[model samples]
Every structure is written in structure tokens, then in C-alpha cells.
Target: MEALLKAVVAGAALHSPLATLVQNDGTEVVLEPPANKGWVLYTVQSGDTLIGIAGRYRVDPKAIMYSSGLEGIKLKPGQQLRIPLTAGRSDREPRVPPGVEPYTVRSRDTLKGIAARFGVSELELITANPWIPSLDRLTEGAVLHIPTGQKGLLVRLSKGQTLLDLSGRFGVSLLKLAKVNGIDNPAEVAEGDLILIPGILARTTYDNLLAKREAERQARLEAERKAREEAARLAEQRRREEAARREAEAKRQARLAAQRQAQAQTQARRQAAQPATVRRSNFVSEGGYTYPVKSYVITTYFGRRGAYQRYHTGVDFAAPHGTPIYAARSGQVQVAGWSTWGYGYHVVIDHGGGVDTLYGHMSRFVVSAGEWVERGQLIGYVGSTGWSTGPHLHFEVRVGGSPRNPLAYLP
Candidate 1:
């Protein structure tokens, strides 16, 4: 019965599709009794790396890694690992064996056409290389492997590098490298090309190129760091300059505001101490008035104005400092001095038939009280004083002690 069972197992193994991959001749193996099928644990010896152990037992290093649960921990002298009894190493990733040719895709090459040209079955070529991302699209300049071929080291050519340069550097024959990579002309090799080289020197060249790439990456990282620091420094400098400019502007504004407050206070005091100017009569007159200042822009109209919404009883003209102000109509000068009612250095004229005209915020008044001034005569100069913002004239036309729109009467 035992002999019959052994013969039956051997017959089943021979019929397996993978039987062709294994040789019939091999040494016999012994293991724990067939009833006990499980992993065996073994202590890690000194200088025993995971890969070395895996190769000795024909097991995959990655499989041992999973069984041992050593995801991040380092192996040491006393670490134990689980070794599987079954053949797990047979699942090793397939590699393109030596002597397999590599083909660079041409513009009009198809997978079926290339297989026929190389006299290899499409399945054989595709099975040998699992790295092909797509079988349908054969992009130009892309490197592919053919089943029946001669082997070499694969290297991607950098800019300005030629196959002749590789032949000289690796000491291999130029014709041999070209034949392995399916290149008709050795001189036609371009930059950014993936090609194969023919000797032991090919491995050395690949290693050197890898080291150079690492060095270049380090240099780029350092340059980027410096650029970021420079940008931050410049940004900080601009922020400081802008802050300083804003501070200076604020200080200037504060000084101007303080000056206005002081002037308002002085006028309020003088106004309180003096008696109010009484109207000459209650008679209301309709008299035509002239422009107070030539070449002036009407800044403030007679109405409610400004943030405080004060009732502006007069019209304001914007002009340069010391611009002459003229009398609106012929009348007796009612008052020509600092006003008791916030009008600094002002002039009031009583045009009979009960109409009166007043000019406020003057630098100086040329006419005195009771002086007869003609219409269009220069009575004063424009000034920024007593409730004034800048160099401008404040003109008013009063009828029976009430003010009217100056624009309505001027023209």
C-alpha cells in the first residue's frame, strides 16, 4: 500500500503543467511527518541576513518577513523566524534572462508585427516580461524585450551620450552592443534612449550613473532651500518699509488735527468775549451779487455738509492762500475785524433795503467798519482760520438776518 501511494503521488506531480519547469533529477528531501504540515521556527545566528537565509532554504525573503511579523524591527542575534515547509520560493518574480534581446519601438510597429519580424510567439515575448504596461499601445522610442535574443546591461542614455562613448568607456565592442539592442547604426543613438550594453563593465556604468543622480538631487534641494530663505527675507523688508511709511503719515495727520483744534479753541474764546454784530435794519432787499473770488472752484455749497452735518450758512470757494476777495455789492462796512461768532478777521457789509453780505476766514481785511466799499473792490485775502479747513473764502448773503443760497443771487 505504501509503495502504491508513493507511485500515485509521483504520477500526479508529472502531470502538472509546471512539471516542465522542474527537472526530474534532484535530491530527496525529508521533513516532519506528513500529518504535521506547518512552519518551523529557527533562531537567527550572527551575520545571518534575511536574504541569505532565504536563498539557503529556497524561500522568499518577503514571505519570511510576513511570517516573522518583523515589519519595522531590525533582526539581531537572538531573533527567531518562521520557515515554511512548502515551496514558497518558487513564486519568485520573473526576470528577463541574459541573452534576451531588447527592441526600441518604431513609429509604425505593432505587437503582432514585431513578434512576426523577430520570429518569436507573442505570448512568449509578453510572458518573459511582465513590465509592459500596455500590450495594445507600442509607443515610439519605448524599449521592449524579445524572447529570443542576446543579453546585456540596460542603461538609459543621458543627453549628448552615444553608444560609441559607452563602447570606449566599457571597453566592449561597439558592434556587440548595437546587435543586442537591435540598433542598425551605432551613431544614431540619441539622448534619453534606453539601450543595452554587452560586458561586465555595464554593471559598473549603471552604478556610477545612479550615484551621480543622487548627487544632483541633493544639489537641487540645497538650491531650493536658499531660494525660499531669500524670498522670505525680501518679504519681511518690504513689510517693514510699508509700516514705517504708514507711521509717518499718521504722525503728520495728528499734527494737522492738533493745529485745527487749537485754532477752534482760540476763536471760541475771542467770540465769547465780544458782543454780537446787530443787523442795521429788518428790511429785506433783492440785490444782485458778484463773484467773491475770480478763478475759484465751489468747494462747499450752502447746506448741511461734512461728517458733523453742520448747517453751512454760506458758500465756500477753494483757492490758493492770500487770493484777493472782492465785495459783492456797494454797501457800508458793518464790521471789519475778528468776529465774536467764529468768523476770524471777517467783514460784513450792510447794503440798504435790508440786505447784508459777509466774508469770513480772511488773512487780513482792507476795509474798516463804516467804510464805504464798492462792488468788485478787494476787501480781504483768503485764509484758513476760524472753522476753516484750507485756503478758501466763505461768502454769505443775508436778508433780514437770514441767509440764502449764494449761487441763486450771484449770477
Candidate 2:
């Protein structure tokens, strides 16, 4: 440049408008033809790169990009690019940095082919060009800015390997690796996907890495399968244990029920013995009856008490469970145990005069059936054994065999 400046002696007339700029700062002046050289409407040919196109026209790549409004666009054959024959005086060549270059994709071109052609790793090529839309496929005519960054290693992952693993093995940040591969979700990585280990030059010393990863994946799957089998076995064991427990519980309950039935049968045998001699009562029979239980509350009064109500045969005497009950009048004990009807464990006394007093809902009868007893004698205890709601005694008086209110007879 000093020689060129010295060659033009003082007062020598410079020919082009760019001469002044070139003379001012020789380094800043792009060595291209003057703007007067004019521009040509050039048809984009096959396999044309932006850099190659700018080189052919002696113009700045940025100038072409600006003129075509294709800063991050791909180039295709049959597309027209305005090729200025000369660069502007103020224009500079290689608009991008020194480590980066512009690449225009043409028809029948592929990312791999371009990468191999340029002896660059595909990962670097894609990363340096952030405008790339997808990873699996390249745009037909995308203008790529290829960055000559640190060399990269190209490796195809086998089954069960992922980008995360690649990042770990290759010492690359997961984020950087994902961005380079155009991955939105790092976990969505697939096996057999092409991986570019940035900053690592292509080599074969790490051939065993993929095999190790595959083995690890197999081990994990086997462990998971064993865990599932163990869980199933434990569940089956629990179910069997539960079934056995329930069976034992059912057997225990059956044994208890059988014992109760046998005891009831033995009690029944004590009853229905020879009838006790009927005896007259010493106490005065006020209204021809006595209160069955000593201390109680009249719960349900006998006779129709409400409209549309049925004739309540007996007066319900509410008392605590197991409260002692007495005979209403002197009579022979008729029925003395469980009554399958509404009355629970109960007793009935045939009070001789074609009248019988029924003491229902007894817990147990101390006096057996066919045994005669005087008025106010202890016969049984209060209970809710049959259809009775609570610990209460149902007391009734009868005319012939028909039920009558015991309340009318009691004092």
C-alpha cells in the first residue's frame, strides 16, 4: 500500500472517486472496482455461495445481503441476486468477522454435503447460523453464516444414547449442545441422532464410549424389570396373606356362633319341665296387675294413641339393660326363652282366669317355662334382644288370647 501511494507522485490526478478513500486509509479501502463500473442483474447459478458470488462480482457480501434483503436467507438456483460490479468506496469486504463466512445454499444441496465440502463439522455450521429452522432437514435455499469456530467431532449415537449423554461425555454444556442441534427440549433427544461434539476435533480414540453407554442403558432396563417383578411378587404375597387372615376371622366367628346356639339349646332344655303348682298371690292385684320392673319409665303407652296408629298391644317400660323384671301377677311361666317374633328374649305367664300377661324383651329368664310364680316375683332381666329398639321391657295383659294394654292393669 505504501508503494502504491508512492507510485502516485504528488499532484498526480487520481482516476476514481474511491481513490480519495483509498489514499486516506489504504487498510479501510476494499480493493474492488469503482461504483461507476455499474451493477449487473445476475441470475443465481447452481451451487453458488454468497461469498463466491461476492468474490465473482468484487463486491461486499453485506452489500449483496442488503440489496436482496436476505441477511439470513438461503440462496437457490434460478433466484436473482443484484451483483454490483464494484463495491462502494465506504464498503468493506467480508462484512462478517474473520472467523465467520457466508454460505448460500443452492438446489440439490444438503447440510452434510456442504459441511463435508468445507471440511467443517455440521454442528458448528448450524450453530454459527442461528437462522436455521430445523435440525433433521435443511432449508432448500437458506443462506448460512458458517463460523470457523473450534473444530468439532461428528459421531452417530447408537440406541439408548442421547444428547445429554453426548454433552456429558464430550464435556460440552447441555445448553450449548442443544442450541446447536436446534433442540427445544433436551430430554426429547433420540437415539441414532447425529451429534457434534464442539471443541473436539474428529477422532477415533473414543470408539468405546458409545458401547459403554449402550451397556449402561441395558443394565438400567434390566434393573427396572427386576424391580417391577419384585413389586408384583410382594403384592401377590400381601393378597394371599389378607385372604388367609379373613378366612381365619370367619372361622373364629363361626365357632362363637355355634357355642352361643348350644348354650341356648341347653337353656331351652331346662324349660318345659313339669308345670309348677299354680299358687295364689298374697299381694293385692290393683287393676288386676303389677309393674313388671320396679324402677322404669313408661316409653310407649298402649291403645291407639294417634290417628291411623295401630293398637299397641303392650306398654313399653324403658329400663337399663339387665334390669331385673318381676311377674305382674301369680301365674305359670308359659314361654320362657327366645321369641322369633317382635319380642326378643321373653317370658309369658298364664295368670289363670283365661288371662295371660306377656313380659317381652327379656335378656334372660331366671324362671323356666311351666314354673308357677306369685305376683312381683323375679322372672327375668330387661333386654333389646329381639325387635326392641333399646333396653326396654314390653309388658302386656291379655283377655283370653288377645293382647290388651298392660298400662290399664298396672297401678
Candidate 3:
């Protein structure tokens, strides 16, 4: 063992926080703190061997040798030895108490199911039948022992039902339920495993059976409560959305109506010759503004119109989603982001002649505000953003911040 420790000291020290002790066969063991009971001092008696001393103390001989620091198996009278008392029940094997009866395991039998039926803990059942290999995988037709003295209804645990929850439903103590199932960790209990309850009968004639029915009803109520809460939350969200939509629409309509009234009043002024002070020629491009998008059919014409909406400020062009939109004419971009008032992801461009062109409902933009763009330059893509029904482009020609027909300016 000393040689083994030396061989692994370097590697083991690098990996583990605990002091590792490697055996000769390359098996490693961690050094744990001394057991709670600690060690007892005993004097070597006449004809006492290391093995015999270990047997007398019900401890491993190696533990005795290691604790005593004995180099060899040889022992002398009056030689001192330290016998370790394990922290817990290391020497004693679990046994069923008297009055327990043996039960034959039937097909599809589980340790939890057997213990629940017998009103005992799965641990107690397992403790009584030590010959059984595993708790998770029990064999059919295997004999098991029923622990003595239990009173309760045997019920299989349901999915998502916690032991604490079950205990409350059945009027059983939580600690007792945990104790019976050998469940050290309540969180680790297997779903659908049968477990025992004390003082509850499964028969319908008993009042305890009513507890089970009540529990089921309570579970259903909880589910329904959650569902209703979710539905109410969704409804509230929709209501707020509709309110916002109506408010935006009203504002848009009022703005458009004012623009139309202003236009009507200014119609006579425009009929006269162009003002000498106004440099309208500088604003006019060599060629007039072109269509922003190709292969688009006019859906909603510019002016007061539409079934759902009162006023149409711009012309709506039906275009496929992600269709490229171009600049109507050379201009500097002014606005190039989202608009909550039904004009989402729009851009406003100021052409020289107090005429600003607006493009609304775009999927994405290639240019930003304050950037110069050329005529027919790729500016954005068509999308059904804001209060649009389908993928389309809302094209507007704004003359001095007032809406104008885009078709009148476009070539």
C-alpha cells in the first residue's frame, strides 16, 4: 500500500481534492474523515492475530492494520491496537422484525407497489428482502416479506404528484411517508410508483376514499384556473392592440382630411404662373420620378377610401413579400425606421423642390437618414408592416409636408 501511494501521489494530487490512497492493484480510494464513533484502544491479548482482532471488533483487518500502523501480520502480547467503530451500521445486516410474513412477488410487481399494498415503506420491504437484487428492476415470482404493523390505503403514486402533496391529500404526516418509502430525497421519487399511507382505506365506503376524490377535483380546478388566466391575459393583450389601432387610424384620418382641405384652398394659387421668387426649376429633375417598384398593381388609390380605414394618405401597391423598392428620384433620406401609427419601417426622402417622397411598409432598408440616394437606387423591400392586410408598398408624394398623389409625380 505504501508503494502504491507513492506511484499515484503525483497524478492523484493533480486531480482530486481528497487525499487519494491507491491500492497495489491500481484501485484508488479517497480518505474520508474518521467515523462519528471514532476509534477504540485495545491491548493485544495472548494468541491474538490481526485477523482475529479485526473479527472481534467486526471491522476489516486492513482498517485495523492501517489505524494501528502495523507493518506485518505478526502480533505480540501487550501490543496496542486501535479498533475503528464505523460511523453507522456497517456490521449489522438489515432484517425484517418478527411477525413479518413472506409474500410471493406476482407479475408486474414493484418494491414500491408491494410496500404500499402492505402499508410499509419501500425501504422496509427492501430491508426485509435483502436477497432481491435491485429496487428498480425486480423479478417476477420472487418472494418478498411484508413488514409487520401497518394501517392505510395502498395507492399507486400518480404522475407529477409529489409525496408532500399526497401526504396533505391523505392526511398523513410528510415525514412518515418519506420514512416508509425509504425516500431520503423526496424530489427523486419515481412517478407512478405505488406507496403506502397510514390510516387511509382505499374502499369507497370509507371517508378516506373521499379524500382521493377531493384531491382529483382540486387538481382539475388548478388546471382550469391556469388555463383561464392564460386566456384572460391573451384577451387583454388583444384588446390593447385594437385600442391602439383605432387611435392611430383616427389620428391618420384627421391629418389626411386637414391636408386635403389645405390642398383645396391652395388649388387656385397653383393655377397661376410659377412665382418668380420660387426656384422650382432647381427642384425639377432631368427626368421625373419613376415607379418605386416594378410588377406592382395599384391596390388602394391615394385619397379618402377603404372599408376598414376612413382615409388613404398614400397609394398602396400590391407586391410580393421582400420585393425590392427603389428611390423615386434623387434625394436625401430623412426618416428611415419604424412608425407605430400604421406606417412601420418607412423612409422619407426630401427631393429639392419642397417635395418629399415617403415609402412605407418595408421589410428592410439599405440606406439610413441623412444619406444621399440616386433615382431608382435600391432603398428597401416591400412588406406588410403596420396596419397592412398583405405584402404591399405604400408610396406617397408629400409636397411641403402635405400628402399629394404619387401617380401625379411618377412618370
Best by lDDT: 3
lDDT of 2 at 303: 69
- On residues 281-361, what C-alpha lDDT tens digit does candidate 3 reach at each position? 223343577788876766667776423346678887777899889888889999999997888899999988788999998
Full-model lDDT for every candidate: 0.68, 0.67, 0.69
What tens digits encode model 1's per-residue C-alpha lDDT throughout 304-375? 643324588998776788988888888999999897787788999999988899999899989999899888
User: What residue pairs are clashing in model 2?
Assistant: 73-143, 74-141, 74-142, 74-143, 344-386
- Candidate 3: deviation at residue 314, Å? 1.1
The C-alpha TM-scores of every prediction are 0.31, 0.31, 0.31
Kindly report which residue stretches of model 2 are placed more than 4 angstroms away from their true locations once superposed.
1-284, 305-309
Structural RMSD, model 2: 18.4
What global local distance difference test value does model 1 have?
0.68
RMSD values for the candidates in order, in angstroms, are 19.8, 18.4, 24.7
Alpha-carbon shift of residue 117 in model 1 (angstroms): 99
Q: Can you rank all candidates by lDDT, best first?
A: 3, 1, 2
- Model 2 Cα lDDT, one tens digit per residue, 104-198: 67667777788888877655665554334444355443566665644455454566777778888988999987766557786655443445556
